[model samples]
Target: MTLIRSLAAALLLACALPASADIFKCTDPISGKVTYTNTKIGEKGCTLLSKDQNVSAVPANGAKKPAASPTDFPKVDNSTQRARDNDRRKILETELASEERALESAKKELAEQESMRSGGERNFSRVQERVKPFQDQVELHERNVEAIRAEIAKLR
Candidate 1:
């Protein structure tokens, strides 16, 4: 892949005139060297720019070039974006399940506290201490789920 990209870059640079195009810095993937170029070439698998193969790039100084990432090039599709959305959905589903479980547990504890009060046990301070932490946990889960739900909606 590295050799192919370099040769393609060299060919493209050869076709690119010395004074006409902007030099783009491309690099070899195998080696972490920096490649300096005056052409917007080889970034997109050397297929996007179709300038005639008759011109050439101005020679480089001495700096090594790095391999061209997809970022160095551009593509038209929702592939990467969709993958991110799916990952986000998976994460949110796990979080939502956790929150629901906590909420259920909290509701049960609150109900138990109420039952104790009806059974002639009126020491409310200890009941509150037991329920407060669960209440806080449920609230925190609700808040987080809401925030994540909002973000997921935006992805749609």
Candidate 2:
């Protein structure tokens, strides 16, 4: 008797709730623009779409899987791939070495500039003026070194 009463109460509650209608999409014929709303579209030549039926559910992972690579994609043989990797590594190493040398030179230049005052004026501006070029050079070389290192890291 209690189960029968529970079923009757559930049915009454379901009937009492308001029904939510599907979305309606209306498009402008000339401009090819679309508008979506839950209310029925009064415009002629509009499309009526069911939100629950048309929308696809995403997987539990919360990301769509990537499409597989095409079979006709160009591929190099193992020996050719190895040679390409070797060439890339060698180029990156050479650039890294060059950047290292430049960095050392920049540091030395900055140090030399720091050790001397260019003029008799004891103003802060004078000191800044003398040090700015060396500071800029050091910063440039530092950036170059970091970039070369990053490129080397990317090499296979």
Candidate 3:
């Protein structure tokens, strides 16, 4: 009889509670990106945000358009603009060439490090640490070269 009464009381308490959905927060281990969803739980990097709380979604407002330029705004002539563009292109090209040379130097240094066999460094981690800076330099220069080329291409 007591067990039946306890079950009835539990049921009543459950019914009295407000119905609120659960929110889960998930984070990517590699990218460190965070995402929130309603249905994920107990998975890797997924944690229950709140069981009793409710989250509301609101649409973002549209972007405001830019105001028109003033009538007295100064404008460059076509030939002047063209000359400026040519100068910009030349600068970008020079930067791209420099970056390419730096990248090649980094690659050569990394190759030399890899080829050298150090008797004291048997561990793979130590080798990786030694080569990491060279690798990073190569990657940085490569990205810079790519960006300079892109800017040059965008020139009129």
Candidate 4:
């Protein structure tokens, strides 16, 4: 059953590749596991699966060169581009300031929740459950602040 599966795999692999490849079936002497490959093995257990004459071609480098910009492409004026960059920086700075304020508010709210004690929440797990939402809110705001600061930094 395993030999049939190995032969099926070899046939599928041979079909997938170009007809030039000479498929080989090899069996491990120690493990008795059957394997198939295109490359010829020096071991005694390897046998040629395909009898047709093999003529393999080495493929050339496939990396593509970048295309040149067309002559008719729209060009932005330096002053206009500078104005756009300045507007973007101002927007990002405003967002960063807003996020910082939210982060501070979240921290304060989290602190308030942490300071409050409840008679019903006697267990430590109950206390943790009560504070979890506040903690999540604080974490979310902190992440937002960091992301906003990163965006502001990228403007430079």
Q: State which candidate has the highest lDDT.
A: 3
Residues 21-98, candidate 2: write the lDDT tens digits: 566788877787787756665668477787544332335467746768899999889999999999988988888898
**TM-score of candidate 3 against the unseen true structure:** 0.58
Query: Could you give candidate 1's per-residue lDDT for residues 54-135 as a string of tens digits?
Result: 3343335655466577765866469887887889888877877877787787778767755654443366786676668767
lDDT of each: 0.63, 0.77, 0.80, 0.79
Give the clash count for each candidate: 15, 0, 0, 0
Question: How well does candidate 2 match the true structure in TM-score terms?
Answer: 0.54
Better of 1 and 3 by TM-score: 3
- 5-88: candidate 3 lDDT, tens digit per residue: 799867865666454678789998878888877778346999988885655432236543566999999999999999999888
All candidates' TM-scores? 0.41, 0.54, 0.58, 0.56
What value does the lDDT take at residue 141 in candidate 1?
67
Among all windows of 10 consecutive residues in model 4, the one with the lowest summed lDDT is: 55-64
Tell me, by TM-score, which candidate is best.
Answer: 3
Each prediction's RMSD over C-alphas, in Å, is 17.9, 20.8, 21.1, 12.8
On a 0 to 100 scale, what is the lDDT of residue 22 in model 4?
Answer: 75
Name the 10 consecutive residues with the lowest summed lDDT in model 2: 51-60
